[model samples]
Target chain A: MVRVTELTNLAVDLVDVHKTYRKTVQALRGVNVQVRRGEIFGLLGPNGAGKSTLVKIMMTVVRPDKLVGTILGRPLGNRKKLALIGYLPENHRFPPYLTGEELLDYYGALAKVPKAMRRRRAAELLEWVAMSKWAKTCVGEYSKGMMQRLGLVQALLNDPQLLVLDEPTDGLDPAGRRAVRELLLRLRSEGKTIFLNSHLLSELEMVCDRVSILVNGLVARQGTLRELTEHTVEYRITTTGDLAAVKEAVERCGARIDNTVIILNGHNVAKVNELIDLLRGKGVLIESVVPHRFSLEEVFMETLGTAR
Target chain B: MQFCALIVDSLRHALDRKLFWILVAITVLVTLMMLSIGFEGGKVSLFFGLVEAEVDSYDPLAASGKARLVGVVIYGLMDFFLGWVGITLVIIATAGLFPAMMESGVIDVVLSKPISRPVLFLYKYLASMVFVLIQAVLFVGFTFLVMGLRWGVWVPGYLLCIPLLVLLFSYVYCVSVLVAVLTRSTLAVILISLGAWVVFSGVRQAPAIFDTFPELQKHHVTHQVVRAVSWIPPKTADVTYLAAKWSNAGTSLDIIPASAMEDVSAAERGQLERSNQWEKEQLEISAFSSIGSSLLFEVFVVLLAMWKFTRMDF
Candidate 1:
């Protein structure tokens, strides 16, 4: 539950967002997402799961059928407030006739950045993205990765408070992806909220402070990394003595018995101790105990399965 | 500043198209052709005096002769060439602008900017006219210079063609934008706008066509409907008369001189007389009424396009 008094602290607070395409395909259904200021929030889902649609609604690129929320303490689609926001849409195409520098200047002008500031930022961002040499090259001549780098520069031109990027690493090499990850961290450190929509679970696991998993036009799960993956932790105890002697007893203790291990499915320490004592009574020597938590990929798969 | 940026972007985009340069080349060629024709005293010389013909009434030293020369630039160059052919090519060249802007990736980034959709749409629509504006200035400027330096006749009123050309393009472009917004298809925009230009031209000329033919004028209901419907679409046909009137190029009789009419038979002279009368009546059409009504129609169409643009999902 969120208090009304905390709305100012949220960079994005969306409630009951719904969208239908062509009156047949329902893209989003009652999506509610919140991103706190200065935090990195990730939105992950499979293809056609309304992740892009939700992002588009926030950016005002797509009109929602019914949306009730505020962004950056103001209502959605507020033009003045949008100056404080920057967006890089997936598969974005810049005007090919313009050079990279000119493209940035054009978009910066549209973003309402002053002329002097636009030029300064364009130089800094191009260099920061390792694209200084390609600044004068027309976008039509650029590679996909180069275009993606320029897109990042354009997105950062206004120095927005809330940066929204969809598939920011869609067409990059390992070095480029790492650079983007580092850039996101740098932006976060500057107290700018970041909303990242991506399908790369590991990437989100590496950076996102909290994430919501969208499944079939609805949020299936929403929480921090620990909150989502910790519940499925399993404790595996390896023993020296054969586990056939205590198989039935181990099953009765709510543990599964392997040939040389007892697999405990929960975080109950007392239950594990009781199982160990029973094993010791049966003369089984415990070698090692290892606890394992599910990865984000596993958690995502499980959420998808459960949602289905 | 946002609108200026959009205009610059649009100009750069237009510059990249081959058709733009091709039009520029054509303008240069036409200007060169005009430069090659020289007038000395009462004689007209082609190819810079390589071929000369005597004409008593067309001497460049006289006021009437100078007016006729200015009439050549105003009626022949501005009206016939720039008004019809140039506008058609511009419509073809710029028809893709709105549809291209609405392409998925392109529109996504633009709409995300701080500007509202209507403002963006209106700005882009205005920016797209930079192509016509540049062409008109170059064509008229070059011809104005040729008349001043070569023929020794300077008509400053001829400069009005620049804004008048842009206004005419906007009248048709409003419809093009409406169609582009409704259907994001360049081909549809081109076909429909060209077809609409024809329809507008036909409707504009229907009254004159009826007046010229006594039989058509006899149908009272049809004549009244044609006259009423003509007020709705852009007055494209009126632009020629307006250009002639503003430039002070005089009537067809004054421009043609009495010598040219001497060879005509009585029947042909009567026909020419009625044609000249119609031209006089067209010249009498009020500039405010024509331009104001056309602008009203453009505003309505543009508002309709903006309404659809703001409501669209892209």
Candidate 2:
């Protein structure tokens, strides 16, 4: 397990990737995403926002009309470098004919793992995924959640430096989702970079170190969870005073008064202090001040609502 | 190493389908039928009413027919059965291969691997060839044994069937891969490839038919048109015909079709000889020129298919 700190600084640094399919239908438009080492980065977008296409470009599975990127410090599409990256496609369909163990072996061999290592790793992965009992069962017999677990095993087979999972928990049950979330965090802890593409907001909120919201072939918002949600916040101030004086002082201080509460519009601490002083000067005591920050889901909605 | 894995994985892919086992079973059944052929008397006895009465009167097996000629007879029988029927069944079993492998959700997993797209494409094409190989081995191996033990004539030329059948299937499979890449529909690949095969076979034989009838010739130069048409596609039918020629070690002229040799007058026999001479010249391409020409055409189509496949987004 190689930690990102132990390696180079960036796992993925892509710039201005534009993909136009068949001379029409532009799928990606000048998208730039920089993923730090050992971080779980979430890519959230509505359907057809090109999140999968972006990952495909990084994995060298999709040929972009114009591409500028380095994956794991190597130029995109470098065959040797791709061995250091693992990808699980959205709605992935592994060959139904292969047994669970055979599926791992097949992908492990593709990843150029040695025979002994592949055998040992396949067993270890199956056991880790709690799928050892079903190792010999044909994949067609596995449930959707089971397939997702097996897919994750395949993605990890190479002990990749960067793991890209498209809709990783799309078909998983609650427990399965929780397990995958924990597994992703563990991978991050091991210093492996993760690029997760999914539409599930809460899942991303819970696990991702940083996130990017994409809409209409463009990046709508991108930053750490705190960075995205902390700017321009609405502060809730509770006060015990006459409503009219509170409203006048609140209006004078440039904040909206929602009944007894003063809702400050800006994230500026100076304005909050000024408003609190005004309330104190008016002989009204401030009961409490609780800063309200938006959740990632709200940021995602606000980001995509621009497309309307 | 990854290339080998893709090939082995694809073989498993073929084996997973019931179509593969069914084709193997049919090959075994046909081999038994070929083995049931008895020659207790000077007259031939074919079991299960395959040709109970007609095979007896066939001049190819007349008392005057030489023992080496028996190899030619067997060559014709095996070539017509294995070459034509066997190759057709193989195409039916395999035409959907590239399309099925390239199915949307499926192909992404393979394309994402470290292997180069062109290498993967070509290897999977070879993997689809595996389905035919198993049948070819069983069919030719059993037929070789029965031909040697029952007929007492061991023609090593029988070994050419395996490679030749592979070439024939490959010739048509290029079309399958191209269409599968373009459309990703197994039914389309099967219909279009088999349809192209029908057109190629139809064109290859049309010249012979046009040359046979003076009435058809009087309408126009049909054989000339057929020759022009035949020059385009890989000469698949001729590849099979060349396999029959190779089966006889290139020494024997094609035996006249049994129906054409029935009660022939001397004057008509002379005409038959002239016709057979023209036919012999048509089929007399050197083994190198024969297989090589078709293979070059297959290569051209496969290259085009690979180009599209590598550039493809999925």
Provide the lowest-lDDT 10-residue window in model 1 chain A. Answer: A1-10
The candidate that achieves the highest TM-score relative to the unseen native structure: 1
Candidate models: Cα lDDT each: 0.88, 0.79
lDDT by residue (B190-257, candidate 1, tens digit) is 99999999999898988878877777888999999989999999998788778777877644323334
Model 1 CA lDDT for position B120: 95
In order, what is each prediction's RMSD in angstroms? 2.5, 3.7
Q: What residue runs in model 1 are displaced by over 4 Å at the alpha carbon?
A: A1-7, B56-63, B252-271
Docking class of 2: medium
The digit string of per-residue lDDT tens for model 2 on A1-308 reads: 22442266888888898998888888899999989989999999998888888988887778988877677777787778788888898888888889999888888888888889888988998898899999999999999989999999998888888999999998888988999999999999999999999888999999999998888788888999999998747899898756685676688778988767888875799999988888887788788998998888888887778665
Interface RMSD (Å), every candidate: 0.7, 1.3
